[model samples]
Target: MTRSTPHVVGRLSFDPYEGPAGGWGSLSGMAKVVLRSGDLPVDQLMRQNKPGGFMCVSCAWAKPAEPHPAEFCENGAKATIWDLTPRRAGPDFFASHTLTELRTWTDYELEQAGRLTDPLRYDAASDRYVPCDWAEAFAAIGGRLREIDPRAAVFYASGRASLETSYAYALMARMYGSQNLPDSSNMCHESTSVGLTQSIGAPVGTVTLDDFAKTDFLFFFGQNVGSNSPRMLHDLQKAVRRGAQIVTFNPLKERGLEAFTNPQSPFQMLSPATTEISAQYHQVKTGGDLAAITGLCKWLIEADEMARAAGNPALIDHAFIADYTEGYAAFADFCRGADWGEIERESGLSVAAIAQAAAAYARSTAAIGVYGMGLTQQRFGVSNVNMVCNLMMLRGNVGREGAGLCPVRGHSNVQGQRTVGITEKPELAPLDVLKDQYGFEPPRYEGMTTVDVCERVLERQVRAFIGLGGNFLRAAPDSPRLEAAWGSIDLTVQIATKLNRGHLFTGRAAYLLPTLSRIERDVQDGRPQTVSMEDSTSCIHASDGTREPASPNLRSEMAIVAGIAQALLPPNPRLDWGAWRDDYGKVRDAIAQTYPDKFADFNARFRQPGGFHRGNPARERDFSGMEGGRARFILPPGLSAVGFDDAPDVFRLMTLRSNDQFNTTVYGYHDRFRGIQGTRDVLLICAADMDRLGLEAGQVVALETVSDDGIDRRKDGLRVTPFDIPPGCLGAYYPECNVLAPVGHHAQDAKTPAVKGIPVRVRP
Candidate 1:
């Protein structure tokens, strides 16, 4: 065999990017991805992020109340072009590629092959996908769904789908006698929903996009807002210009958090437009967020006690706590008694650092706490979230302008999906309301989520899987195991715009249904349709696709779901699937009827500028949803680690997306912010740890998971790169490192996979 030209750490570079975050570099990246899919109309690009145009389904960052000249980001362009690409995967392409051959391709290669232009089904004998009529595919799916017990089938929804589509799909699942409706939220922000709802009587963020301008302090914990939500950087820059303090706590020093130059500024284009993002940046250890936040709370409590002793105004919101919240006395006792030694050891930060963070927080009048998967994808994920809320509550931040908790969501419409009842666990009142409106008895059983679905599929409990969007195989944890379980299912249906690995890993029988993307116009019965989306701030807005359908065969997601419902359920005058499919307005009316108070005048409200704000009780300090009609300060299981007792040499492995990719879709191999290019196979480790472990910079190592489950989980051939990450903490690209995370390991309260805090032993 020829010498493999031994890879030498893949050209690791520490040269930081100094220019504005989104100037020429972002434009070039956007052009490269967009041009790869062939040229598009200028109107299509201009219409993106405009009022009366489509929302960028790239992220869930709240848009401005009004439209700007360019409201899109680099990732938004990538997502739009990735879906509306001119390249087509037709019969000839499938005929030439076999299942075995396609399985060998990388995820990027699989998706980059092209968009699925027609309905296709797996032909086991030929080991390739063959064309199938839409009616035949729908019939096969509906018939199989009917054949199995509804409890054995799962309906999965993705964030890319519209609100109307998700509502219809949820109704169909409930009508079919199963509530096994798991959506993408189960993987990303389930902890936020569980913790926030339990703590403050609401599951959504209270701060709107405009709140960034009025805040005194913004604390970002375990979130890379710049990389994940680039548009938010503009707001951070403005916050800094207005003399507000923005602090960041994370394992690695994300360059995006250090400084950002607003590309939209002309002054920045002429001179250095550098705006310091974090007034104070603290690098917290992996899985150490609970300890860190608790430490901050402890400092805040001590400061408050000292302030009261000095006859100063109370630092803690005593009036608000006494009147609006409960359990403060117990929570205060715990924080006052917290050990500084353990806090420092666990958080990997000195007492001074925690005090510094507390000082910034204490000095501010109004503050906002923001976080992402770094806090949520842990064994103590819910506790981590609750601690953040506890911190906000100490200063009377909840239900107020410029203050509250904000869990930065990854997808554009994931929040919207949850708002429209795309949950596995259906509330009894909502089910009753939907039943009364639709004239069908809805399923009342608690359904499976992402983690639960994985377990059930492995145990052969689930027989059929129907996905509205997203790459289920790649997004789920324990890929090798999930792939096997997914293949063993009786029937699998994927409704998507592009080809992903999920479509190739067929079940006993699988069908691929192509659907129109977010940017494509969905004209039902000759009238242009509009769909609503909820932002991170709980603001609802209408998104109307402006471009023509990518293909003549491509059907809208609503149309496909309606067709399936019509095929499965007998025709009925009360639940007329045909009329609803023909007119989305009727569907909106039904939504309003189902939740009259929340979605009043659905059509008219959706037509209003920036849509309309759903009534948020938390904003009005209405704690009726909570116990005893008051917000509760919950004391969670104090602090923990992921198999920390297993091995002394074990390191916490965090699975994160590179700047080049979204959740699972790889736009390119380069991560510009981290300065790595053309590869995702390198392991990022601290320089001190590299030396302590006796590993060279270019060494290729094997990562073996440290667990008590007795099952070996290992990934090999990862090049070691010494970087600025925290010691005892390692980072790797996801989907590749997903195999190292056991399916049994998940957040206790939320059931979200603990992908961020995997215990792994490295070997050269």
Candidate 2:
């Protein structure tokens, strides 16, 4: 592809001279960049930094450096670059661009503009957004909200919102008498939460960052760390250096797992001394993860039996099970009952492969099982996660250093939002505490989740949606359906740093409130402010951005949320909303008081350099659930592996991620790792599958939806590219491919849409 081809994946075409080096050095160097726009070296940026540096509002990953720098990761750079770009959307910009005109732009084009400068309201007659006073916008929104059925108002929270703002938003929604709290988590790791909560008492990861260095074996299932979570590469490298075995089970062979050039090593990047990541790579078929894990468990059980018969030490951790677990006998019985042929067939892996993986786990001193959305976005997503936890519990893997489960989160603050109580179902204790501390009874009704919100909107049961900071309409699945649903709403408010497709899909009396970017300074009560974020490891830290606000008219998310609350609630209310708005410390104080068990003295703790680590129940091996203690394995029912009666022409379509793109955010077109550039329109077909279908590389083919439902959602025109993938499994990008997915198809328990493994038929 020529340079003029409008690269979709920015990093692939990024010139080394345009920024820093391509790999780790570039990442470390960019890490120093202040959250703001100006170009400053790492040392200078750090020197000028106060407490709050530049925090990416998009993701909760904070750059809290003593001396803030302009450097960030490739994805971080993409986020920062997108944030710092010299673009604006003011009244005039909107005046010249009609809502109809803006809708014509692609998702990427819309967000490329820096920030929304003024609060905007859509005018039906003009078909354009007009600037409105903050008070007018707030009052208008409050009035519309009051008119809506309390059950109909769905309040969605993005990870980008500050902990203080998120709390205020949740409180306001509750006070308004709605339980509709749809969040990004519903789309990502709700399965992890559901599955883990069943096995252990919590949904978060059991291990901390410190555990990476201590773990002897690392099992990565259904995740591509290098592209999704690059910072994890550091830990993988560290573990490899320490002689740890990292086994990866994924459908596609990810480049990051094969070898990585540690930019930290002077010679590695300069030369070719790259570190190999995965000791054993298993290309299990899509939807075969559960079966693969089951096979491993079966192998371990057989090993334990063989060892006992040989008069040797017990292969399983029987002591741990007796002292710290429950349901062992049941789990063991289930494992014993698993048929080998069923395991092999369902897992799409051989019995020997399962045995090899099991032997590795049995011999390891400690093992950490890490996964991502790939494991969670399936028809059996919740069961898939439970099986992983079941395997870990059987071997007594929890509550120990280097031995736990890690669900890699996408947005940095996505995990943090949930940590700070952004949920549809807040526990009774937290609810009572919130009421006692704030003097208002939070709505006791269970709130609507993401899917529920979409369905409610479609049914006209939901009239207003106030988004803190996400491209909601586009971020969701069934975009066409969601867009139509959003259009039916009475009021839609988006507080964001940049223009996105969501902003364009506005409702009547819609408001686009501009907010301060994480890099910018947030001041209240004559003091600079910082927001706290909870990382994947359950580490809560303060994030302070260093850049100036894109526009002076922009307000911080906390201020915007509080302002809206003040407008909505009566003056003689239980909570002192005004006081909290004046001082963020007051908000933190409330948070501390509300979550005393988890966060004590939130203000003081946040002052600490790296922030504070929250206590994990599993970390201490405290399985605080039924049976009066220990974690237990919940064995699932076995089924004959579901396989297609091979029609010689049909191929299963597996949705994959391109290196240049994130969930719904496509940065550029090039997937350098996949050796593809300048296009997302191509499909990855196994060479053999292509041959059997009488197709070759670069063959133009149509993918038809093979669902029993008479829905034809696939685009009629798509080019096929023969690539390396397991036979019977084809690869395509998401959102585009999401059309082919049936709305009814989702995880049995978690309700997460099954995006990864979709069965389809190929056409010539």
Candidate 3:
């Protein structure tokens, strides 16, 4: 074995693994064993017979299969291991440790203690939390709310919350005359929602997983399936087996996307078997997705014009454009006028390469375009999505069997919670339906978004915060600012399954209430209960965890929300909280009645094997916009107006996820894709950049983040590792780097921080 010196930074170290012997020849042999052994628990989660089934709550990707006896992914295993760990943060633990001492603990150390046991209050005299009764906690919270201005209160929700819990929480905040409702979506897919809604009349993806299996071509933009959404690899593998051309456009060459071995396939482990996913891979610059996509559209139009002159059929879908789309001429004109030099410079893709991709797209009968945070966390995030929609519109891809748009969503029920009305800005139709069904007037004023809540707290407007499930303080951009904002709040309430960084950042009076994990059985009203999750493919299914609750005292998120509402609300004339709490079925009934067009017989339909898929306007080719057509192409202003201009010696830093971790939480330090092991403190740099800077592959360096507002946020002790990446670009892990992002530096329309693409200068 040829042992190489691994990179080291801070308290972490990275050691590369030498898989077997030979080069590409040995890859097939290694894959065979990986498939047979199914080393990763993620593959097992997708099989049927398992308690939780194949659905991943961490990332909403599901498929129909028998649940394996031991099912979970690396990240899922991390989530389960963390959840099932025999660690407890009880009243005795709190008594032994002061708030000051606990604050000094790392996020990993604090959560290692397991689950929270009882409600506790922070005593300023002793600077420690003491056990308090549930009633006292509620009353104290209510009293604080009554004392503060209504607008001064902020209620935040994490993606772990179920649809029922989210609805109740949203209702509680609105009824209390406050719109300070910040949610997890603000940091992730808010741009997808905003852009798709404006351009396509809906905020969700147009394609289903079935489409992936049937499509002739698959185009991935700014997404890493291996770490961000591993289940997606199964679909990609299927597509590759069917001879579908798979193309990937990302800043890094993700290993999972390059090749994958299906652990479920019996022959995979026994023989030299693996799927080659990316037929063509392009390493686009950070924040350059919009330009790359636009260039593809431009090439498509040019090809169509050329084909038309040859007396052959036009490359563009004229029938679909005429019958279903609007504003085609304007978009085509914009594409015609675009400069190739500008596109090449910004996207870091040669004109010939983009033209080849465009030709492939035009030749294919059906194609699907998928993207993730790389496109959404940029200055013109919404606009980038619009550009993608426009490309699909040009080819009449929407509402087709094998073609449409797919915004790979993060979190299991993030999209489901939004569908059930966890939004800060609820539509008029949903609000009206909710009021009519519940017999209460819903608030008319627009509620606070994630950014709004942070601003409110900074202005001393928000006094109290109640989180359903998430690490908000750590996940949100600008940790220092968020930490100070938390201090300004009078009371903080956290209803969580496990310990996270958010719990350590306490307010004057705080309570850490433990809740049942998603993988644990939830018993309500003397019966086991199962909650529904909506996957990225628009499929809604029931998830029942086999594991027992962490503790008897730990309640479901629904129960906790109900308890708080029952404690705080006056004897209400409308809105029956008691009926909803007795059984979750009542809440489903209300949902069915409110959204009859989509969620009819909500409870009954969810009992099906794979559940039911929601109505997809694009799948049906029913473009229900102002144009009264299918889908139309809308021209974006241009790439010139997108993102910040680079300065001398400044490289755009893009935050990424390791294979062993999820958002905000670090499971392990290893990143298997880049050959990194046992450490996340390494920075991926282009070889050219390292040579230019006179730096070696494993050199220790300090990363200084320069915010748009001229603030200097620095993270020291990052080992630089040279990799295959575009010049003028750098890569690092997130949350730890989230502090370097400016609080105010967000997408123009969506307000999502550009965490994936931030311009910065590195110091030695």
Candidate 4:
């Protein structure tokens, strides 16, 4: 590996993500940013994320039935102010800046230019984007879409798009004869959807927010609770107060899991008070979760055998296993046969530690398991998730009160988008039901995923691309390659609220369509409209915006979808597109008509207080979707090692988000949790590896991927920082490091990009 340029040294503090001072720092930083935005309405700012007000656009954490006085977190406020800021980037702003010049701007700088005020299209003659009318923009987009085969056009939906908007978008795509519904989920939680459905016959989380109170033990894996799901801290505090044990597994010892001082707690407001979160923390190697789970099961199975030999009640749930599950005997035999030494070598955990965690699980009356992308973005992601279900099922955890599986979603409305038909595989939603309701035959063939879409575009198979909302270029793996591949398309359109790098990097013809944010009021046919969003717990609630649009020219996402639909397909007697656009209730009614059993009276139910729970059959011990109408304990193939199997010096790299960022959006330069300030270009490695490489904390180095594929994937100019991670593992912030993740390397069954567990080599 060869280094290109020296890295800029960034200050690293030894403090945790949040304590007394850290809590106040977060609030102060949020306040300063909000105030700098200028002249924000007092009432709207105060009531921003509370119930009966706009929902927070930050995360997908579930809210309590009764809203707290301060319903928002620091990141929530950042997202709110960022969306509702007074700054504007109108026609004049674009006229002064060329695409090449704009491409030189940092992600933070680009977004800080603020809300887009008008629709703009790239004008080759001027070498800049120029103002275009909504009608003209839609006409151009529709014309190009019609010229190409629908299979050649890709429709990408971001999680920020509301259920109503997504429903309309999905309908339009299928009506145009395409099921290329690639979405943010394909990059994030596709493994959760695939694995959970295979394990328990459901595609979403089975646990509710209230289950935290009744759970005796909570097993958390691969999630930074404080930075990602801040509001969850309160629930964790309450759970700790009630004597529930919290166990965590991660490569690094995150401060959020160690201890937390809730900013909203009255008791901690006056003085420095903190609550300990994880009672036991295991430092699992990156991509080593399957091995860790296998180890736990191995111990639990042995304990059950011993207990049964002693004439005691079996440690396992024999009754539940006999009645509602299949393949338990084979799974148990494999678990019992697993080598403890190999498990320890792979998982980076001692046999005693695995037994300790298993003992906690065995003693608990009920337990809940929670995980995130750390378990999903790997070669064996589905197997890892299935092992989690296997461990929980060993004790009849699923379908019981206070116990179930919770795959914490990273984005707001991601679950809802999938529920309303934003999926690459149309088979998930009944074609007969949609055809009966909308009088259109949805494509039966499975469409492209994120990686598949990129491959098609690279091969010049895809001609047109439309992003509902997101910086797809920055979010995907092998970003530079994807950027180049995008140029082959004839046209690209971005439905967005602010400027982003994706808008600058585009096809031959590109358009940026400004749209309303979550906090902006939307009106259709002289009546205020509300959008429904589903939380991580599958709770659907109505969010009505309060503030006026940042720009009057902006259109609601629903209207924009309708505009394009009308332009391409026009109105027909069978489907009145105008009615769906005029009133969102009609969209919800249509949703109920298509999926009547789950969303009965969708309009009436979503408006009710606390909203409605889209119940899962698996939650009630119903595994009818399986071949035998029982949950199957699918056996694992073997260990999916994080480090290279043959290369002794190879290191596993894990990509993560900074506390100051959300997905691909950079809110600031500081990462308070990791104690790094003002930079996002440092590599976190264990001190032993640092010594072996003879590198100092601020030493600049390059990383080159070690793979059988000859294509070189490298990230240069990264400063090395010694930290407490597994010996053979390293960590870096994503979007910057996304360049090293190969599009060809992804989860086996899910097809999600393998952002984590990339094998790499260090360069001096």
RMSD per prediction, one decimal? 2.2, 4.2, 4.6, 2.0
Q: Which pairs clash inside model 1?
A: none
TM-score preference between candidates 1 and 3, better one = 1
Ranked candidates, highest lDDT first: 4, 1, 3, 2
For candidate 2, lDDT tens digit of each residue in 1-764? 00112224333231112111235534543443223234333432342213445444333332332322332345555555556656787888888989888887765667655578998888889989899989998898888887788777778987777777877787788877777777888877888888888888788888876788799998898888767766567678889999999988888888777777755566876675678888899998777788899888888888899999999877688888898877888878888888889877666789988888889888899999998877888777888888888888777788887899988887768887787778887562277777676677778777777777766766777788889888877766556666766777888998888888778887767998999877677787767877777767776767676567778898888889888888887774556777777788888887787788778988888756545777888788887654577676877645311223334555556677765656666665656577676567677877787777788766566677667766565544456677767788888876566666655666666667677766678766
Residues 322-427 of candidate 3 have per-residue lDDT tens digits of 9877788988888888899999998999998888888888888898989898888887888888888888888888888899999998887888777877777755
Which lDDT tens digits does candidate 1 get at residues 246-328?
88899988867887766566787567657888999999889878778888888888889999999997778899999899999
List candidate 2 stretches off by more than 4 Å. 1-52, 55-72, 426-429, 572-574, 639-651
What candidate 3 gets wrong by more than 4 Å, as runs, is: 1-55, 65-72, 625-630, 640-642, 708-710
Worst 10 residues of 1 by lDDT: 1-10
Q: After superposition, how far is residue 305 of candidate 2 from its true place, in Å?
A: 1.2
Cα RMSD for predicted model 2? 4.2
Q: What is the C-alpha lDDT of each candidate?
A: 0.83, 0.73, 0.74, 0.84
**TM-score, structure 4 vs. true:** 0.97
Report the C-alpha lDDT of model 4 over 232-276, residue by residue, as the tens digit: 887888898999999999998877788877777667766767788
Clashes of each: 0, 26, 19, 0
